[model samples]
Target: MMFEGFLFVIHLFLHTYCQLQVVAQCFINLLRWWRVNKWNADIFLNQTKNLGKIPGHVSLMFLEEDTPVEDIVKPIVWCICLGVTTISLYDYYGRLRSKKLDIDKELREYYSDFTKNCRNSPKNQPSPRIQFVSVENGRTDLVYAARDIAQDLLNGVVKEVTKVNYQNYHKVFRNDHPDLMMKFGIHTTLAGYPPWPVHLTEIISLPTCHMISPYNFLDCLNRYFKIEKRVGK
Candidate 1:
């Protein structure tokens, strides 16, 4: 009778152990499922949020002194597809004007090929107006800024006119300011972008410009949206 009792206790213990093992496995699976579902949900929510918000204007600055204009065309096209109305590309070296003919030729070829290949080409949609500016333009604006300050002083526009008045006058040359500006290079410096437009603009730095993908452009837009801009308010 004692031997039978011992056998019965052993069986009970084995059964309990098996049940515990099953429970532990189930718990682990449940945790994995929860994590996977949560990750998928977060991705879906982010995509939905980005779709609702689109920047009106975007700007790109090539921090490197002699960046080729050809390297910028793809990024500009990607920005246009994102529904940007205005795009300003700035290069510190001012070589863009010299390469204008080559850039124009390449752009025309790209447009032709894009219309032929892309089934949902943005050609039918409103395209962004692209403008190229240089550090020289910003320097020239300093002269305008000085002139405006003198005029404001002479006319007594305000009791105490400061740098803000000068910035306001500098806007006359280019009215459409960048909503978001991305600097392409190792560093985050503006490299002489006009100060007036950047007061409210969000700036981001990209590692490089060569062989940049559309996803990189989208990532910059995403980063822009994630920031909270006070605009000195």
Candidate 2:
């Protein structure tokens, strides 16, 4: 009976050790796969740049309010320097009372400074246009405005609909659409960004927006290039 009990203890220990070994091996393999995927993504990005088809418009989404405006603006500057045309910045938490107004004021000030500095710089080109929209509040306003206009047209209060096209509707919403949306958060959720512009927009979620760098921006562009956009086919 003593010998049997000792054998049972040894068997349990061996089983536990094997299970731990399996888990460790899985973790190592996952790490290896991640490294390889990153390497491949880098190579693909370089090749795409060589092909000269960078994303035209990029949107960034984040929740934090205290994140320095410079952290957001610097990335936009870098994207513009890289020849991206339109940049959209969305603050999810800006929907709170007075937050959106504060954000807008700060952005306007930053943009004014940025443009002033760019004009003074010798290497200045046409800077990309930056637009800030609070996801929840802005979208609601846009939808309401559109509904009012449509209602007016139906009631014949506004005569003569000159154009009946998608572009006309786009104009109504001010044409603030994005080609790729980069989300800076732990979760992959969109956090209530406007649904109208993202019909085909590629969303890339990053771990966090605390310490964004130029390389991180480049990686986003790389990921954007990997997406094959099939527009409503």
- What are the lDDT scores of the predictions, listed in order? 0.68, 0.63
The alpha-carbon RMSD values of the candidates against the true structure, listed in the order shown, are: 16.9, 10.8
**Among all candidates shown, the one with the greatest TM-score:** 1
Q: How close is candidate 2 to the true structure, as a TM-score?
A: 0.59
**Any idea what lDDT model 1 has?**
0.68
Residue lDDT tens for model 2, 1-233: 99999999999999999999999989966764553234322243343456357667888787665665545555665555556678777877554334546545765554454445332331345767666656554567667667767887899877755434333544223555677888877775777777777887888888766546556777777777777776775
Residue 138 miss distance in model 2 (angstroms): 5.3
> Which digits, one per residue and each the tens of the lDDT, describe model 1 over residues 176-226?
677788889997577877776778888889998754554566677778878
Q: Give candidate 2 misplaced runs (Cα > 4 Å).
A: 1-51, 95-124, 136-139, 154-157, 160-173
